[model samples]
Target: MPRRLVKVFARLNPRRSPEDSLALRASVLASILTAELTILAMGYYGLITTVAVPLLTAAGFYISWRRRRERNLLIKLILAVMVVAAAVIFLRELAGSLYDTRLPLIRLFLWLQVMHSFDLPARRDLKFSLVSGLILITAGAVLSISMTYIAGLALFSAAAVAALIQFQLSEDSQRVDRVVAADPWRLAAGSFLVWLMLVSVAVPVMLVMPQSTQARLTSLPVSELTKIFSDFPSEVVNPYYREGGDPFDRPPQFSADSYYGFNPYMDLRSRGRLSDDIVLKVRSDRYDFYRGIVFDVYNGKGWEMSDEEGEDIVSSSPPFELPVDTSMPRGGTSIQSFYIQADLPNIIFSGWRPVSLFFPADRIKIDKYGSLRSPYQLTDDTVYSVVTEQPLTAGSYLRRFPRAGDPAAGPEYTALPDAYGADILEIEKLTRGLTGSYDNTYDKVLAVERYLKETYPYDLEIGPQRSERDAVAYFLFEEQAGYCEHFASAMAVMLRSVGIPARVVTGYTGGSLNPFTGLWEVRQSDAHAWVEVYFGSAGWVGFDPTPGFDMPGDASRDRDNFMLSGIIDYLGGIDFGPAGRAVSAAGAWLGRGAAWLTSVPLAQLSAVATGAAALAASAGLALRRLMLRRRQSRLATAGLSRELLRDPSLKGYLRLLKRLAGIGLARRPEETLRRFARRVSLSTGSADFEELNAIIEELRYSGRPRSDGDQRRVAALSLEIDERLREGRAATGRA
Candidate 1:
């Protein structure tokens, strides 16, 4: 057998070798192609500026030039540098990508590859470069799972095959004196075919593998996604500006004034358009607008609302009555629940005096101010059910309040830095004038709210106008047309001036309701702010001073922008485009209306559809087989015999092997005829094994056509093998 194999190889090419020039050419081409793929993957055109690409090109040219061939070192070097430079710029642009920003790492790998590209003195360097390229492509896969990544996978596989061919070509080059053979295209095409076959088999195995068994990793670099509202319960210097608009069109942008942790980064001052609909959903029996950090003192630019240790206030729970008057009537309602998920934070946006809040799972914590909080960064959709009560009357609570005696309420709320513009006293005066007397706090709040709604008109173009000297005052007195913040701020300050206690509340309001699911969907456009009036009988009455604006739970706003809802619909094969509409129409025509399907319980419908599909497939396959059999019967048997008997007699032998496998031993494609026989021999009982050998020998050596009688004997042998396996199993069980 070994001698026969040697003869076959010798007949083909005992002394033939590929030339050095051809081998060198293959390496150079591979390097260049590899660089091109890297550039395409990174999506940056300025890679030519980097030294890496040039270095690689030079290395390739030098090797070629040293043998007296014309090669340009400078051109090679320039290409390498440009490719690397382009890659860097591409990565730099993805500073905010959470997972798909590994392009920089790929650039570094590509540069190393370019630097070593031309120096392919040893086959090892060339092989290593190709391998590194494959690694770079694989890394890119971690960024995205799409058709583009599949293309990269194909490219990587093809490269691997090419590398193998290069190794073979290089070996042939070293022995060129004997005989010459070179065909780069043929080698590359062969490698690609082999790679494709390997991948076809690998795909099934990969799908079977559990995702958890593989690495759970993110490709985002040093900078991670940062939360905007982390300093929960912190004082805000909120001189409210206009708020409320479409979140999808433009949303509010929040950034820390200073760096918090180790990650060093800055923001470009930009603001998103306000969302008119409330993004949050409160299911509490009691009504309250969800609240976040509150700023007591305004510094012209922003508000300072900190609930730090020194700023913490005493709680006002029942048993241990607050130092303030308990005689003040409290609102009867209790246990208000809220389901809120927004682009904003988990800092609760609720009525001022919240008694308790029911959180999703155990995610809620509280700051010293009794403000609800989140366990970690709030990214996913959240459902918060809070329990709260409002004061019944605003008048009684304002009198002889604990903080009322103290001139400075708290450092965070009172402190005015040097940078702060002087508008505090003016705001106070206007607030006092709006609310006539401290005894009628609710009346004062209403007066202030009415003034804002009557005075300023709602507009998004106020930011630039309000950026001038005395912007808030200008916005309240002069501009006449501003957004929610401008109106809400004016209202809050006016209420405070009359000693009718009040605070500016910023949160989402009036949400859009999804007709499909009957759930309020909040979008980026739902971000909003309104005034919370102090009522002694009720803790804090939630109110919106924006003239035409409805209070929370009024249920007038549209809410269809859940972050993942859109993405989930996409993954689940729900399309809203023209193609999707066509598909929907077709489905309806086929008695599979989209509405009906959506109405069905997801699990039950999926099960029923799967079963129906399986039945249909089985029926179709049976029909196809019956039709094929009928066609076969109409054909002449003699012609079938002629075609089978013409050459090789390989078909009969293959059928025999399959029959043998059906019982016990099976043959692998990679195995030789002899190896298959050896495995058959090991099976206990010689009934079918002996008979099989007789047939193989007759077919191989004798080259004789088996008679009908002989064919029957082979069939009998196949059945005997089946019996042997059955008997073996029986014996094992009986023992």
Candidate 2:
């Protein structure tokens, strides 16, 4: 039909035009290459090399030749079969995606694009294919926040510009009166310029846009996606195993033995390595140990809860008031919010002596030793709050006051197994000199703490104790080296031998603070053990005997302030007054709303919130529409032509182009006016055409200041070109 179509079709004709075919193949190759980079960015390299590359290559080869040929039934049938297979896979994945719906949806979208890649026969189809590549790149952006995605985006942008420019130029090559086709080098340079312009605009917009604080959608289910892709054993994927029973039957115990620090039982002899995996993110005004579980009984080898089944507190709703008495005269209060990152047991970790726990659970349990446990297992989705009252043990008033032991808490706090009597004797002998060194109980506990810190070395990889000796005895008498657990156990046992009611408590130490989130990232390595001694009036006072460990009061305060300084520095240049005001107003409104809603039932509260959100959305939509309509009306009456003519240089250039067209000397579609004017001047023997061309080029391309004198010169040149063109036309007609 057209010359362009003939050229495109000739590529498929083996004997007709091998060069055209090769060039078309190169363009298709560039498009496919960039598409593969995008696919790799989405972490689908296996699929790219295995399916996409070969399929796209074959499709491109077939389509380049088939532009003007009749549709082949065999190819149509093959494409139909592929569509059917992809549909079946999509349905299967959709049905199986019970754990995460997004994974299956993304996979199905990818499959559809892959199937469509083979059927790209027309120029429109090729454009659609490139658009599909863009869609996949967007999916990759949604799936990853890594720097690799940025690199992929950059590469894809460059390749896409090149392919689109080449495609447009090739299509236009068939049109009548079109100028010389763009060379490959010119096309590549234009693509580079386009990419640079896009990046220049995009970066500023990205910097100014509000950053989201929500967890990334892609990172949320990455582990689950990895499981689907990896070649791991079935047992590793599905951890439930049946023993001599129906395979469908549930296992006897939910094995959490893999998480070393969180297990209910702790064997001191077995020194297992800890992972750096983050387990908890906490936001609180003060820093303190995130107490998980406490073990009152210490057998010779390990620590265990004396009673595995704790007493459950009966409650109809949440905000469970723990049995801990926070009304003590010397108690200091703090509020904490926790977000769990990893799957953990149904234990609620908070600062020492939690007074009130607010969660979505129906019932909660507390052991006799002040350890809080949840009614259900907690995973990454679990978020809860705790209101804790830490005793003001650091204060001068509490340290000076000599409080008697609580007889009610006597047996549980001071209880030690009879089998460890040798350990008790050794503890007493070792602490004999320090027993009478302090008159007050606080001073006595401090002395014991000082002794452990000064005498012992902290070693995570301590050797196993002898069969005859208890772990405490070995750590205190012979080894003189161990981790937090050993130091805490030794101090507690030594205090108990001297009639002080002390017990070892297990929990996480203060974690590293994240400046961006204002949350403490508590890793598995932060797991620690410390001693809590019972004081009659002041309640249980926490004391860490670990060598490098600092008390939560001073250490946490300093660290929190340091992290806050970093946050301030990060936001140094940004104006936050409006944002701060908005946040404060939102907080105040939420506080008031919560206070009012607390009296209402939870079901009603949820309904009210949903209704309120819908109403607000509707109002916002109506307001936006009204504003848009008003803006359009204003623009319609504003005289856009008059506004454009306000610039004298642009006005003069337009007038000159219009005057030239009136004389039947109009510029060609692909020709620059400067070149057109030079040709015209040679034919007409007029210098005015060249002069006018120079003035127009300067005003358009040079980006220089145009004065009144330049404007007057442009008007004079335009008149002279018009007169010369008229005279030349008359002379030609007369000849």
Candidate 3:
């Protein structure tokens, strides 16, 4: 090793002494704990052996540390056992059928840390253990994509900083007269500040840095970790298997209930609370139902799709056009961009009639029903743009002019199962008057939609129940109060009964608009079912039968009351007693600022902001440097010792006392330090102040020159007092 490298290593590790070994061991253990948690977050569930081996090694090390008489023998035995176990595990992994090599390698590194832990009698071994722990954490980072990993990384960063600080303090104890330990609160605060700074710097650098255009290199075939688990048996080592084997050899069965809105087969009778979690964010000129799937075949039980294959469109390149009926007249086009925030199916959601798609994929498939699907599963990272036509506008020429029939739609749209026989007749009875009341198919469809919406009340508390008859029939005649599914089903069946080709379409209702991002936030609870009648020349026209649920295009009509626009209006109209004038003035100021911002080019504004941030950072750095220099000069003039200047023991204790006084626990003039400490400890249920009092007493009475150890003890006690004070303040705030 280079001399400089050796010096750096020696500085970090130091020579192991009895007094410092305990602190080193504690630091190493903390690092190990952090590494373990990070690995767990990375989805490594086979940590039984990984955890057990380290714990056992720690126990043995503890025993060796306490009993020096048999230390050498114990060390020898531990090493021998560790070597044999490691060899066995290595050979086992080599012979195993596991496809992913990363997991086994991580396991091996974890075991190596365990072995090193037992040999941490020396400072070098402890340093090695810390490095190994860091490596394990980095490995976990490579494998994880969960948001929880951010939390894990934060925790690991704090722990690592603490460990390194403790290690350096242990090293300094050997060279300095007294090494005062830092306050835990101050240390924690400092660590947090450093973490924040790192994040701030990293974010901009990441944005500006040149990103690799090359595809990611992987040891194994690309696959989702979740899919791998779902594909293979728990006991089986190999995940890939031959398709269409024996029923017993197939992958484990997943409950149909798990995929409620996304699945082809939807059982309306099955009732459960739908999650309110945001699934997608959509930016568009107008609000529209983000259509996902289309089920053409509705049996008596539920809805499903036909087995007919979709035509695959090459979408790997940009601006992939979807197959559309050129004969159908096109209306005004709407461009929409979607950002998925949850795990959905391969289906791509868009408005009623999507014309083209822009996505990063090799191929996408489109069915006759105009449902777009990707070749791969859609994840949170998936982003796509869609351009769609406003097919059925209220004042469209196509709506006024109707064509004969669509042979292209075939008999599938009008086909009804034998199970729907009685329900079809029941629907005919309900919509029988529609034929006489309306001339056009559009008016007849609207009549059925209006009838269902007016008759049935919207309710989501419908419990799960099995019906002897068709679900739609049960909803129409029996359960009059149900959600959108029931209303849409009834309308579709009723329209079809009157010879109008209609199908129940499943997607999300128009979502709540977020004015801040100018995006519509579609949640899982927004999953809806609606009716779509084939208007020969006008194309598929969406007709929502659910009461109070308007189509996305119509959603703009109520936008002022539905979103931030409503909030602004309400704020403007409200009388706030004495604050009304102030509120109005503030609102006016904000409005002016928004107008100014809108007038300026965004790129120019971004450049100005960037320049301002850079200038501020530079100014801050210069100011900090000047302050540090002034402080050094002042210390020099006072002729204060470096040890005393660096130590915060007295200042920290005074701050703690001041904090206590603020909390109505002022120290008496006559009360001794120990007595006051004991009183405070008893009252707060904390003994932290007692240690600080002990250090103060030692510093006051002892005649001997202060040692590095004494300084460290004092610093540590000060930190403890500060931490306790912080806790008390936090608790008071919460109360």
Candidate 4:
């Protein structure tokens, strides 16, 4: 009854369906399967689609094969219904944000591909399936943010190529009204080999290569707000850090996934290393520090935000206009979208001097230190966008803004909190000695920054500071080696002692720029701290006092070594070991060679290349022609090599064709044997080979077994054709 209803809804629209092609169906099926796996790899579903997709596609394939010969009006009608349903689902899913439509659109297309699989009776429908699979791969690439998607892309590409080759063979067979000799295995191998050759040619052309991957996404705008329940509107929340736990005692350090500096208070007394697990992915216009939280009140041990009661602002729409600090000199705007890959603090980490936000949360808080905060902890996959005013960060440009002590920056920024000993006095004396030569605040800040970096070696293996001894004092005077926090603390302390308004700021470094994905991959190990020294109208300019770290700035072109980025980092860490320096030296030499090549004019190189290619092509053509002529001459004179025939039945036929070719009467690729024989008879003024052609035709199509009489007739006919060809050749020569 259901089938009758469906049939009644649709007509028997039998649209030139081809004979059941098992090979073509299998290739298309493989391609569709590859695409499905790719979408799964791209994190399309949690459990529902993951389990349902495979079962549904498999069932569809089985059902399609079972009813391959049927002109099922019911199935077509159902598919039409599915198409409409999918369209409706997509339309319903459409939202204000572009990113919001991605998953729904993918789901729609993917399900449609699955549904279309069940009714693929025609070669055209199978081709449609193949093209649909290609689209799925493209969709996967669009969604992919890692180089791992290459595996799926490669698999789908091979399957699609095989399907195309099969499609071509099917078309050929249909045109000739017979099954082609090309089998599935041979088709796949030949097509893949051709595909590889095309890829090889294309790779160099692309080079003349551009990650071969770039930012497939224009924006990552999202809106999924989480309500804040804490006393402070936007309090720092680190899952790894124990909030009410004993301050003196260190928290459990098993995974070390979160950075301690991300908390409200950065306890220098706590010593451990952060994991390299990716915490964030940022797509930005340029590279800059993703500053999270800043601390003004600093004790001898650690740093903290004194003003916990921050001002909160609410906005229903995007983008939330952040209050700009009038004192901070702003320049061009930068748009950055942060994609949280791991649990992080509530801090709205943006480029320096943020003026606007696109965070999901309506209510956001801004503290005295100019750090914007979200309502809830940024869990995994949480995304937000921010637009910041990137200053003209040239040291000379900043130095132009002359200023004494910063009036805008309050006294809390410059004060050294009380400690046990006369450590403050000793630190003040030490800082004054280093900066006495420089008059301006910027120059003094530079001097302090330079001094700290030169004296201290950045090390992460150092033990926690003693309870009594100050962290920065010990780092500067005693230990002489510490990581980012140590360097930042020492610099900030020195700046404050020299009557400069400075504070320690913590967040992630401008992360590893994945050339493949074209996104900044910020990891837990990227958690960093640096000193922000206030320069009146120039504002709080960041300075990296760590030995190997550079202060994040708006670089015109920030380059990362892509070869050493994703894979090596994903594994524990990279270690070239003993010969690391030698490898580095070799890489340097290669870089120099590349640099030299870049200096040469492209047009001159192209001209020389074009000339060489033309010359090579001429030589190749000549060589191939010479080889072919020699082979043909040898074959024509070989006198009865019929024993070399794989099928003895076709030996006489082949012989006839070869002899006819010697007399300038070669059989065309598209010509039938009967038509060629008729033309041959006319040319020779004889009808001798007609009988042999008939025997072969019967054997080729009707599968008629050859008898002794047939074999004798074939031999006599071949000899007669050869004689006729010789006579024809002689007559032509005489003429």
Candidate 5:
């Protein structure tokens, strides 16, 4: 009779039947649960969904794609398109933000997984999904330092376990599947063991891997030309001065008897100063300072060309020729070396004077005013080496003013501005104050230098100045403190007044060397200026009077604080101090405290203890099975079990009623006993829906969740829904 009722019910309803296979059931559960868990985990960590969702989706796609050959061609095509679209989006995003532009690639992985969910025709599809899960977890790790990666990994592990379970059961359905379900304790124990093994092995590999291993690392913007000057430019500043005066040489270039002396120029850049932190390393044993530009004269408002200027500097493609006037002494000196790493522009800095320089494959050109330059900017690190000539000191040439026809006078110095006469007198007073006795020009110059160094302090800040203040006079007498320009300019003006020619010079001072690469890391802040007093034979003598400051090659370089910065960054990794530490400790202590509290029977730990609780649960399930078997077994002996099992209608209705209760509106002891019957009798739905109501009333009101009569009703509903809803939707949509 129950079997007859089941057949009637099955005819009326469908989809009440169990899943076609164990793998399909497990896959559905794993995918849905993993998706939900990953979403929650990423959300809790405060990660943007663009990163999290795409990662999860990619995992799904990987699982789907792994079954390539067996998957339907149409489904594969759809998934492929999704993957490509995701990649495009990811690359486009990279152009916007420097952060997490890699997410779109993972998005493709997700769309493929969704497509894979449709047919799932073979075991390979299940395997593919598992692989995708693993890939997704890996992608998540790259995007953050958050613990959400750990959670995704855990979900992946769980899915793997479920996949394994399904695989094992599917092969021997009658044996393994039923046998495993036969004892819930054994199945749960097996799952625990598997989880433990997977996590233990995975931890070591994760920890030992190199963190910076990225597949595509070489993406830099193309090199572009960076111009230093766009006007009628000279490499060196202040290039013109009067005859009989050489500012680069120390001491007086002329005597009072001659009336010829250094003509002082008002430094134009004196106010617009340049600063930099550019670094260069000299790897050669013989120290050769890099030479840049040389200013040969001084003009009142800074120097410029007195006559025809030279050609524009050009960057060449390959071979280069030196532009030095060879008829003059071959002052060239060879220094060989290489650039370890440098990222400054092509403008290389060197020592005081140079005759020739070897250029790397790129063409290097010298402008009319003697500045060597290149067209391209160095965005990435570049390296090169060269040779240069060193200037001799003052112990050689006798003190004497230049003749009227001499070439060093460069015709530009014949005229002095009429307005400078008053300023020159003020300088004479300051220089006279520094000296009481007259000797050779060098000694007299040294006396003035000694006085200035001892009397004035150095400062870089520019504060309010008096309106009529002369820069040189104010610094030497009133302010007594200023940056490099002030000290250099003051000395130049004082020397010029006393008939001892001098000029101010500017360039970069050598920088601190990086020990790791032994390369000098020069920065913009090293810009410096000093007075180059004419010393006749020794060319120009470089001496600094910036109180307590030492020149390069004169002092020990101080080391940087890289180690401290590294330690600070490392300490920031996991929460440790005050608020973060307190939060962590409180969370940890809460777990222990809760565990301790729960040890008293009802809060956390099982009331009966692990062993006792397991036994109790086992007994409950066993008692239920026993009661079920006893009631059904007796009826089976009467030939009812086999007959009812074959009755699809009864089985369908019973399954429908059970599934309905799960959705909500579960049967309760307080529910009226006749309520279910009324629902079935007056049901306006299909016959199978009505039949399920009556059967549920019989079994559930009778205090059983299922029965032979109910089973038939469940079978009918299963057939009905399968045909009407599931199949119908697809057919109409496709049509």
Candidate 6:
């Protein structure tokens, strides 16, 4: 048999290896493609950056294949220099990412991966490329909050399994100068089966792991302030929605692309189903509202900010103090940074009582209401930071003050249009009814907020409010069910009529915190409005009357399955009509169940136990089959020593070696018997394996057949090694 195998090997010379198989090359490309795709999903790439990266990667692979005829040191040196330059650029850009530096580092490696693609001349280099795909995918998984990552991960895993399988075959084929026992389709099916098994194990394991509720964040950021262009009248420009006439007009209104409340004059009629597209990502020290455009004037129809002469804040740079109210008491300091993910209004959003700015624009217009507006409209990738001294807003502090009969918030806030008519009286009567029992302004605000939340359910499906009636009146008396806009508008107008200085504030409610990124993902659906009531010396305090919504200051402990919700949103957005909605609804149910399973300790523990047992059983069956096949092959074949497979001592030693390999002590093809014995000795923490190797070596070299006593001695050593190996593996927690 040995002579026949030698003759076969001689027919195909191992010295001059053949070109890489198409399967091997394609597998390598698939792995590279996965890494590139992961980098693109991170949302930082520009149009050119997005298009150029994958093109460069594909081009690099093509170059490597064509240039495989010869190796070039110069080419490698140049690519190395390019990678180094990319790293230098990344480091410079990293100045802005210090608050969360993981992403920029990952992005740097992505660029390195692209540059290194041109030099995968050897199988080892291709394998390295395959492994780097894992690194990139893992990094993307860590930073990405979207459920779309799950799909990308699936793609990478399948490709990686196939790549590893092809690599194994290629390595073996290279050793013999020809493919051995090759069945491409069978191997392909095996890879798929392996992937399926892996996915099955991973899903249950993940389902069993407890989810963390760590949304509250305190982080920092990147950017330098640019000199302002002479404080341009920062107009509200909704890039996706502004395909029309004045936002303030009646005829051309209600855009699905934009939140109506973001305009100069919010028309309550324009409230529709806002898209679930993520708009902003915020990293802040504490949970708080991203306060934006504040409106004091209620025109019966909607609300608008008063045309007070605003001050243009022209500064050389950022971190400058804002003109804040000296009368308002300062509490804990909170720092926040914003990453604009979508084109938005020119308003600068910050936590309550913004003390300083890190805005990029040279100048910002500060309205009397303390809201800041930038000269430039915010576009995607716009970055800024803010330092805020949160108002002494604890309930205990606010409860100490009484409701001022005449608030010091000035007449603009309390001024209601006479056009509101008797409808205004009805609002006053309702507000007084809700807050009549409360002695202090804080309690009064809470009472009105609670009443609205309980009585008027927040429903986004409601149509535009009637143009004939006051928006607030219609919301309170007729519909009694509306979203944040109607609730906020009603609350603001109601408070004003009842002699409390209140204004409607619009911006995004800080969305769910991404546990991985530590950033609040603010979606378009998260766009919200709430009322801020004045309490003489207490300053402006925020209140939300929308159902299922709380004040911005409150930290959210109940983090829903946001990842699953993202999946639902993604599915819902696909233009599949009613079927898409059904899919979305199904996803919602799954998300809820997942959230429950993760939250409940008993459920998680049970799942872990079940999954672990199933995996263990499967592994045991596979290992048993593998060992049985190897044992049968060895028994049938003549090999190893002078006595061949018939010799008892040699057979015993071979069996012992196979046992060691079964428990993950497999010897490499290049390892000598003595070297392999040494490694097994370390792995199993037993010298018995070495003793068995020595006996077999001595007997084989001495040209003598093994005696019965020698066979018994070998068996004894094997038993001792098995016992010790188990002890060693268990000690290391790998058993």
Higher-ranked by TM-score: 1 or 2: 2
Compared with the true structure, the alpha-carbon lDDT of candidate 5 equals: 0.45
Model 2: runs farther than 4 Å from truth?
1-265, 314-317, 324-326, 330-332, 404-408, 417-422, 556-735
Using TM-score as the measure, the top candidate is 4
- RMSD per candidate (Å) reads 17.8, 17.0, 17.0, 7.5, 21.1, 10.8
Which candidate model has the greater TM-score, 2 or 6?
6
User: Candidate 6 residues 494-551, lDDT tens each?
Assistant: 8888888889999888776664355677888888898888867777888888998887
Model 1 ranges with Cα > 4 A deviation: 1-351, 354-457, 463-478, 490-503, 506-529, 546-656, 670-675, 704-735
* Total clashes in model 4, counting residue pairs 3 or more apart in sequence or in different chains: 1
Model 5 ranges with Cα > 4 A deviation: 1-308, 311-348, 358-370, 375-384, 394-417, 432-438, 535-538, 550-735
Candidate 6: give the clashing pairs. Answer: 96-222, 218-285, 227-362, 228-362
Question: What tens-digit string does per-residue lDDT give for candidate 5 at 104-173?
Answer: 4554455455555543555555566667666655655543223355566677677678667666666435
Q: Enumerate clash totals for all models, in the order shown.
A: 91, 0, 15, 1, 76, 4
TM-score of 6: 0.70
lDDT string, candidate 1, 255-326, tens digits = 332111001111111233543433444333322344554445544443334442222222221111112334
Alpha-carbon lDDT, every model: 0.47, 0.61, 0.63, 0.72, 0.45, 0.72
TM-score of 3: 0.45
For model 3, the superposed segments whose C-alpha errors exceed 4 Å read 1-259, 395-401, 405-408, 555-735
lDDT of 2 at 134: 80
